[model samples]
Target: MSDSTAIFDTLKAAIAAEEPVALATVVEGPGTGAKLLLHIDQTAGSLGNPDLDRVVSRDIAGELAAGRTGVRHYGPNGEAREEAVSVFIESFAPPPQMIIFGAVDFTAALVRVAKVLGYRVTVCDARPVFATTQRFPGADVVAVKWPNDLLDEIGHSLGQRDAVCVLTHDNKFDVPAVTGALATGVGYIGVMGSRKTHDNRTVRLREAGVTDEQLAKLMSPIGLDIGARTPEETAVSICAEIIALRTGRDAPTLTAGVGPIHR
Candidate 1:
């Protein structure tokens, strides 16, 4: 088989395992069909020139982060602003993760909503009976562990595509969950509660060493201002808020409103 075929086989295996990878192919330029495969820690193949491969590798990282695919223009020897080459960068990113820190009725509802949005949802709680797979059908994982302990194991892997939702209204559960989620690089951190509960959480989070900048990252009283009442409705509101935040839209979040969250 050719070098390109070998790279393509590796790419296929990586994608099959849901591992992150990117393939940059010279589609319109010198040495068309030249390929470069990028993984998190290393690279394989080459796009003809070492300089061109290096430039496209950097661009591949950004494209992989956003899970984007498209052609990028560059001059010969990888110079910018000149279209001497067109490399199509294809990113194969794993599904975004959504870890729900409570196994309540709302958690089940949220799991369904998150899965519908292509998130790999996990339901976690300290209570074994509540955090069973039977209770949270369709969840990718059901962990009966404290929020902090669970985060300790997997927090480092979380990136901009991941989300953490602290739906446990209880102080004992919410405090550690919010704190742990904040420590990660996850894109969205939402805590579910009423205005009063959010105020109480804010104080506790502050006492727990959560800084002002980190506090701003938490979407307390989570979800959009869609007048959600039932658990199902609330789940929809929360998922909607997640999408809006990811897209950088100006939707009114529950945290931004005063008084009651429900109509």
Candidate 2:
């Protein structure tokens, strides 16, 4: 197989196995199709020079941290000046997590939507009867415990790529859920409720020591203003809001505007 094809195969396998990997392709200049395959400890393929591979691999790891994919110019020896090569670094971060803190009907819909969005979803609830693997077959996990307890156990695993959705809508449950989620470094914390419920929960969250800056991390009144009436429609709204928040896009329905569907 060609070098580029071989490197791509390796990247595909690593992604399929959920292993962190990156592919650096020489998109411009000499050796246009030259490629490098890198993992945390090992390296495969090459960009011609040993020093260039080492330097580019290290830089690619940093790109992977932010889950970025883009092209960068470099000298033949990987120097900053003189664009002898242009490498496209594609990061394959570990799958992002979706921790849904409710086992209600909305939870099922959210789990389905999250899965469709490529999240490794977990369904959590304090009640064992409500939080069952059978009830949420689409979820990767179903935890029967208090939200704070779960966070205390796995909060460290959460990071910018992870999301925590508070759908319990009960002040007692949601307060702890929001508090626990905020304590983590999760990127998104969406709380499901009407405007009135969100207003009341704000007071409870403040009492629980969630600061204004921290509360700002929350997307209360949860989904976008899509006027959704069904659980499935609400799920679409919530997932769309998550995408918009991540991409910094103003949430607008496709039918309401004109643009390329994917850009």
Give the lDDT of residue 171 in candidate 1.
91
Clashing pairs in 2: none
Q: Find the 10 residues in a row with the least total lDDT in model 2.
A: 254-263
Error of 1 at 137 (Å): 2.7
C-alpha TM-score for every candidate: 0.86, 0.86
- Highest lDDT: give the candidate number: 1
Q: Give the residue spans of candidate 2 off by over 4 A.
A: 1-13, 252-263
lDDT of 2: 0.85
Instruction: List model 1 lDDT by residue over 1-263, tens digit each.
Output: 38778898889899878899999999998989888999875789988899988898999999987889999999989999989999999999988999999999999999998999988988899999789999888899999999999999999989888999999999999999988888899999999888988888889888999999999998989999998888899999999998899899999999888888766
Candidate models: Cα lDDT each = 0.91, 0.85
For candidate 2, the per-residue lDDT at 2 reads 78
